[model samples]
Target: MKRTWIKKSLLVILLVGILFVLAGTVYLKMNTYAPSEAALAVAKTGKSEDQILFFEGEQGKPAIIFYQGALVEKESYSLWAQEVAKAGYPVYLVATPLNLPVLQQNAAEAIIAEHQLTAVVMGGHSLGGVMSSRFVSSHLDHAIKGVFFLASYPDEKGSLENFSGSVLSITGDRDGVLNQEAYQEAQRFLPDQTVYEVIAGGNHAGFGSYGEQKGDQSATITNEEQQTQISQLLIRWLENLE
Candidate 1:
């Protein structure tokens, strides 16, 4: 009877484990956000080199390497990249492993080695942005001019306070998912002169072309409007910095 009971328990445990694995698989698949209409449009002229999608804008223009959020498709940033490209900056979107930037921390290395850009601005959204901060802080000698964050913050693990480059952090007022308290706390980790902006009525997912996130609030402006504002403001800031 003891042996029979032991076998039954083992079988039950195996079934439970299988169920959990199946559930996790379903969650990951269902959360795969599709690219917006603008993403499809940008795909026409996009170029790929070393697994990074490059929006070739103009020669000698500033190059921006943007990373995608966790579980979010890399091309979900196409709309914004296109706008940045229109502003005469080459935008390179790094494709992360399983759409997780944290898994591939050195994803920017390939882009930097191949692009031959003089001054590079590196950034990402959410988790992606955090890893981007890590890359920039470690690679200060690579001529990194600036770091941008979209609904993201530089945590204590990797602070940007000592970084001699510019920092641009853009957030949304109505973002329900981003940790408000943590965001405020992380401000100390950034440089004193960080250029921070809060978009009125923008939500957490406003920075990307992805669909509505689980806990995100409704954005007052369309994705196009937000992307336009971001690209325009970024270009203006880049121009005025000199």
Candidate 2:
């Protein structure tokens, strides 16, 4: 009888665990930020396969693998990706499970291998950037050419202090959603030569087209203006990469 009771208890725990996981998954899916109509319109021009949105560019340039911000739809970055692709660098906007890059931080490896990409740059906005940094740090042998962050910073575990690759960090001057203290602290983890820039009238939500984020400050500049500057900065940086 005791053995049977123990078995029943185990079954009950297993059932509870499964229920908890299901509930969490549903919650995450429901809370996701969908792309706006403008973003959706731009995304239609790109080709999507599986979870990746591919923006084709020049044949022999470094490819970009970008992850999406937490709970933000991958399509939200479509407009920016299209602009970058026009500059001759193919861009792959990757969608993460539950819209959280942290859940699949090493996703770029598959993309790199699938396309046989040699020179590659990995970047993202907000939480996506943090995970991309973690991936770069963990896969140093991948020979990533550069890393870029939008309103984000790497965590201690994803530090690139000794990395030789190029690093660029762009943040908005009026970003209320970004943790200033943490961002300042994370700077020590970046390489000495990292290039940092700030958009004069930008805010946290200006990095993507997912509408105004809960904690972000109002941007003086339009989203289109912010994105244009970002793409220009990114293209110039990419062109100058060694």
The best candidate by TM-score is 2
Off by over 4 Å in 1: 1-26
| C-alpha positional error of residue 24 in candidate 1 after TM-score superposition, expressed in Å | 5.0
Residues 1-242 of candidate 1: C-alpha lDDT, one tens digit per residue: 99999999999999999999899878876777767777766855788766677888787776889888888877788887887888788889988866888989778877788767787888899998899998887787887888899999887766898898788999988898899999999999899879988888888888888778989999999888887777777887666543
Q: Kindly report which residue stretches of model 2 are placed more than 4 angstroms away from their true locations once superposed.
A: none
Candidate 1 residue 100 C-alpha distance from true site, Å: 0.4
Q: How many steric clashes does model 1 contain?
A: 0
What digit string (tens of lDDT, one per residue) describes model 2 on residues 1-242?
99999999999999999999999999988888888899899999999998999999998888999989899999999888999999899999999989999999999999999899998999989999999999999999996999999999999889998789899999999899999999999999999989999999999888888889888899999989998999988998889884
User: How does residue 215 of candidate 2 score in lDDT?
Assistant: 86
lDDT of every predicted structure (CA atoms): 0.83, 0.92
CA lDDT of 96 in candidate 1?
A: 82
